[model samples]
Target: MARIEKFEDLKVWQLSREICRDIWHLFEMTPLGRDFELRNQMNRSSGSIMDNISEGFERNGTREFIQFLSISKGSCGELRSQLYRALDRKHISQEQFDMIVVKTDSESKLIGSFMSYLNSANYKGSKFTKPTSTSNHADAQNPEPETQNPEL
Candidate 1:
């Protein structure tokens, strides 16, 4: 598999971002927006899913990343519960509830699969890898190569 250099490249993170936007837009069109408590909670939970994924990726450790992914998965469950509450309160239609639930459920599965991969993978993280070349040290000491022009 190709290297994932950034969180944006992650499929799970991308999906989470899409879900967050969907929730934000859905809430904006409904009276649930007036319910400050539920609105804020729902927004936070959705955002947390994306945030945790990005934060975990940036941690530079497979173990840490897995832990963060676990947290993100929990946030997915929280969002699902909030969807039920929204449906119960008639703040959202049955269709919207089903749609959101499906998205969250899919995200949770993705996160779980990723965690499983991390657990079995031998590549720990970049932070744990040692530099393979001394070229960096030599360049830092000399600051210039003899083959290059002295003046720019």
Candidate 2:
């Protein structure tokens, strides 16, 4: 596996971003954009998929990252549900609905696989790594005081 220094480097995040962009364009070009409430809600939910991934990766811990990935996956499902509404309301064509739904499904799978990999991997996360130190700061800055003799 390649080292992911940033969320953008992750395939799942990249794909999620693409899906979000597509949804944005669809809303802008289609009559769906006219529905203020649904348009805004769809935009927010689609954006959240990648946003959660980015947030989790920046958290610097495997556990937190996993939690964020789970949220992102849930967003994918939510977005799919909204797509159904769009289809039913004639905001989008059946073809468009199918394409976006497939993309969202793929994103959810990718995130799930990544989470599984993280769980079984030996490397916890960057935050869990202990920092190397040649000397103890407390010991170097302050010396221990001498104790009084009990016999005295």
Candidate 3:
């Protein structure tokens, strides 16, 4: 099994967390937190983006891991949507909206690229998976064969 020793090494995940931290601080300035509904929804969705990536990396199963990463991408989208809602309701300034939107979009693309990278490699995450699987053409209509458990 391959180990993901540093979360920072996962650039996409790290950036997502940074974006969330900035938003969390911004939220503190507003009475939005008192709203309960929007506040917790926004917070939890942003958090899920970071948490899912870490959980995916730790799982060390490329297929399932990529599934989780894809989920993270969706969560990033969800967070961005909520930010727009917050802005429309006057919870955030234009500058904050722009900052958060740009970063979130960047994170979204990075997640897509990461997914493409994995797809090109056939969902093989590490040296361990490489010997038994090749992800290169898996994204094509005719998918590559699934990786068997290397243990046997």
Give per-model TM-scores: 0.86, 0.85, 0.77
- Candidate 2 wrong stretches, greater than 4 Å: 134-152
How does residue 146 of candidate 1 score in lDDT? 23
The C-alpha RMSD of each candidate to the native structure, in angstroms, is 9.6, 13.8, 9.2
Q: How many pairs in model 3 have backbone atoms within 3 A of each other, for residues 3 or more apart or on separate chains, i.e. clashes?
A: 3
Residue pairs with colliding backbones in model 1 are: none
Give the C-alpha lDDT of model 1: 0.83
For model 1, the superposed segments whose C-alpha errors exceed 4 Å read: 134-152
Candidate 2, residues 30-52: lDDT per residue as tens digits? 99999999999999999999999
Reference-based lDDT, residue 59, model 1: 81
Ranking by TM-score: 1, 2, 3
List runs of model 3 lying over 4 Å from the truth.
Answer: 1-4, 122-152
What 10-residue stretch in candidate 1 is worst by lDDT?
143-152
